[model samples]
Target: MEMSREKVAVVTGANKGLGYEIVKALCRKTTASYLTARNEEKGRRRSRTARTRPQAEIPSAGHPPKVYQTDQTLIVNFFSLVDFCETISPLMRNGGCIVNVSSSSGHLSRIPSQRLRERLKDENLSLDELKVLMQGYLLAVKHSRDVEDGWGESPYVVSKVGVNAYTFILHRRLAPRDIRVNCVHPGYIRTDMTKGEGNVLPEQGADVVVQVALSDSRGQYVWHNGTPVPWCGDDPRIWIDGKV
Candidate 1:
């Protein structure tokens, strides 16, 4: 995949933090990228109005000037991803990549509450049903900003777990189509998400994304940088012994 031709990519929650940094890296490595933030107005306000901001110029500094309105719910996230795939996938270059920026907080082990565990494990539930259930989860988070409530530390963390599950689902959905879909736990990067408290820098976290995007591997779940993030339970690996 050479750099000149149009190569479209999408990064959700990208107006700031790791998502923004991932877009910055993708822009430099690819031809074009759709940076999706829940707040499109904020995206537009913060992004340069020059009609063309160099990919390298992303992550300049400070909060993005524009913020668009979006529902901070699991349903919205899933629909947006599906809509982007349906609308944009056709125009992308052959080696285009989809990087779902997730976090370690999404793990089942991270959710200590048995009730939450039972809810997430109900496989008979459809995606739509899961989305509905997820609302309750988000509400729980809002009620208690503390992890002790079984909501993790933040709503974003819970959503990322959904994103990780979505990544696996997308990998299956796109596998036969030959499009690459993968997720990465970019680590706790020092950014707005962690309020700049993380030890890792955004650029450092981005290194993991670059590795996944550049590698021939497809439909894989990798953790910080290029290491394979172990699959939970009986879910089979996206890749065969060594191949996808």
Candidate 2:
């Protein structure tokens, strides 16, 4: 693939871990890159180590509303992503790409209800419908009825699922403009978020993410090694010791 010096990329949560490595990797390919983090000082400190100068330091409102902590996960993982896409996509130049950093937990199989899975994967599923589904999930959580509703117990997992589902929705919306949008599972990486208990390194995970970000593939849920993983149905890859 040809690297473009004129291309610009932006990474969020880039103070440390996978997002930080993604910034470093993008610097090697794109001329301008920007990073956002909850902590201003840490984001500035990390940007100084990159090969290219950061275009800007974006400070994110790190904390969610004082509602249920589970709601916080949904806000950060799903809602914020939707907001970011809606806000930045129109400004992006044609042919620009958007890669949503997702997890294996985002796979459709993770949701127990086959009906719910089908609902999320429907091509006709609109952004408004997605919002309603997400709100329904939050309501389920509030009432301690998530599992019974087939949404599962882990808010993190459900949030990632939402991210993956929204990727397809956004991809369809942006296709006419030649803007490719996809999500990827960056493998289980040893990062601060995981308490350093993962098999893959942050740099290794970021490499796959950067690859997808610069590729022509659209509406794909890629595995860490650059393979496209099915969003629905059984994943053929064996899970050894809970690691893919």
Candidate 3:
């Protein structure tokens, strides 16, 4: 992997909250930084607030969206992050870093099933396999069997867990390129997800993101305070506050 010193970073879901703050901070430190929000108009507005807003494509964490939206959460939270990484990786003028905004709700214990947790934590897990697993979940959802099938009622939580798992797979895949891929739980920020109720501020969460972007680390799972945490199975109480 040919590493370059140029500070080029890409942040998704940056239309508001922590993602927005991360892009803002990166602009001050990096030669080039881009903010991508799914809403084009919203992305443009956020970009204008940054010192070096560079135009680029955009991409969310989650909420218990409408019934139809549960599936969309998985698409945006898990698949979009992976797709965006694949799309932008080759275009990186300088070796880059991918920071996925995950949540404590993603912790393995939140899964509640040993079988599913084991499969998710499989070291040999592939992106295709993960997709298949998620497809099954969606199917179960469509049939109103996801809960009985042990996939859990909250698609939002399952989606982030998928992101955590993908973080590991992506880290290994991108290692050869020296382009780090890491996931961070930005604590419970006062974002829309929390309905403006949270212990951590938006910028405090963004601090973790900015640190990871500038570091040499690869494929790490961390908390908002920069503390390293296990990305896989462990005590749920260790991270999850009370489930999202």
Candidate 4:
């Protein structure tokens, strides 16, 4: 494939499943597709195998932090996603797109606390503020009040919700650079992440990811199955406040 100056991409956890398919599609358009994961050997194998790979951290379960990796999930999923976007925005000028592969469970409505959701949308939400909010969840987990407190049983959903909220924040920050940002839930594909339990094929999930990656779409939590739905999984608060 011919490399292009205008388009280049990086995908974390792309070695298999939806992320791998994403790299495959992006390779057709981007000059270079950087595929990375925690397992370097596996990453290289996939990169050569696909012509790809994405991610860090263990999948979340509703358990307290008995070890280090579980707590690190919050850092990897939210902080890293934000930091990566901030760093890449300067380089991706003139209509570059960042697509954060997310999940439908990330929909803030899934989180029952109006107060917590509002904090996520805080106008001055800084990295520090975000950290505080997440740490609150950790405290809740420690005290065994996580479920009643509305973080739910899985930290995975909470982490993804953070991804969704920050996608909105980064869109506003990056708009001046003409770089659009968005997130997508790739429709529950059967992959290692899902332990091969999902209903969709990997390619089917990837087509949507490729679509958003190449488009001017921004601040959207959309999905691509047989039909595409834009502005999905939005918090009712956004609609209530008319803030997008």
Best by lDDT: 2
Return the lDDT, model 4, position 167. Answer: 81
List candidate 2 segments past 4 Å from native. 1-5, 51-67, 236-244
Model 1 stretches with alpha carbons more than 4 Å out: 1-5, 12-16, 34-95, 113-126, 136-154, 233-244
Candidate 3: residue pairs that collide: none
- Model 4 residue runs over 4 Å out of place are 1-4, 29-31, 51-70, 226-244
Ordered by lDDT, highest first, the candidates read: 2, 3, 4, 1
lDDT of each: 0.60, 0.85, 0.77, 0.73
| C-alpha root-mean-square deviation, each candidate | 8.3, 5.2, 4.8, 5.8
Model 2, range 140-192, lDDT digits (tens) per residue?
88788989999877888889999999999999999999999999999888876
lDDT of 3 at 130: 89
User: Candidate 3, after superposition: displacement of residue 74 in Å?
Assistant: 1.1
- The TM-score that candidate 4 achieves is 0.80
Per-residue error (Å), model 4, residue 13: 1.1
Winner on TM-score (3 vs 4): 3
Across 26-77, the per-residue lDDT of candidate 1 in tens digits comes to: 7677647677766677566444432332233233455421111113434455
What is the TM-score ranking, best to worst?
Answer: 2, 3, 4, 1
* Best of the two (1, 3) by TM-score: 3
Question: Per-residue error at 102 for model 4, in Å?
Answer: 0.8
TM-scores of the candidates are 0.62, 0.88, 0.84, 0.80
